[model samples]
Target: MTDPITIQWTPKTGLPRRLTFEPLEKGYRRIEREWNGSEWRHCGSEHTTDLTLHPPEDPPTLEELISQIHGTWDHPNPAVLTFTNEDTVAEINGQLRYRSPTQDGWYAVTKTDLESHLRTAGYPTIHRLSETPYNRADFTADSIPRQ
Candidate 1:
């Protein structure tokens, strides 16, 4: 068994991040991202059955990094779009229709796109919008008008 790999990333904003890659059962690999908070909050995880760790003899290059960041465009799945409002959706369908995550205030992405984005952004997984329907009645107690 090989030792786990650890990588540290310090973003300009928010908190520092740590990434760990560990070998898993059945020749699978697990990659986890955690925020270096007071409590070590978990950000996400990724599982791959065919992950290989390369030695320092061939380190990743800047082009590879850039490719990893922008390669989502070649994904087979269509991207999803999350809009803040109907207007934003309409605007996205109008001008920036080709682009996911509308320019105004929306996030659009397909699963592959999301995955690529997460991987490139150093996030293990991407959070999807809640599919469960929300109702006003469910929030009756918490619903208070702002004065």
Candidate 2:
């Protein structure tokens, strides 16, 4: 049996779904799953012999990305960033921090800095989910888990 090909997507509900194509005897079995916080739950499945998968569509919009930004994975004190209706305002660790320039490797970042820089900045060498993976969070910095 050949290895399965898995595809992932995040919908309007903010929950992530995964579609896996597993090679079968004369066809492929497609398994659909949704992420329920800590695990992936099966939603549905099907079998197809003739199926052509297409490339994924456009990336998530800035608004979508911003909305997904929440609790920090490696934060010591379980920091969370809550965005208000005002674009320039955000509460970090329950303290309101206004729009401002955040230096590299800093823990606190303003909403403006996140939208303008963090989104496009180079990813740290670390896996962003695992410790001792590769890069150090202290030098590069950790990120919220989305993918």
TM-score of 2: 0.35
Worst 10 residues of 2 by lDDT: 122-131
- lDDT (Cα, tens digit) per residue for candidate 1, span 28-66: 455556565565577777665545565446544433433
**In model 2, which runs have C-alpha deviations exceeding 4 angstroms?**
54-147
Instruction: Report the C-alpha displacement of residue 29, candidate 1, in angstroms.
Output: 3.9
Show where candidate 1 strays beyond 4 Å: 53-147
Q: Residue 28 lDDT in model 1? A: 41
TM-score, model 1 to reference: 0.33
- Model 2, span 1-147: residue lDDT tens: 779999999998679999999999999999999999999999999776655666467545545543443434345432223222211223344332322134233244444555665434421121122222122233234532222
Give the 10-residue window scoring lowest on summed lDDT in candidate 1. 86-95
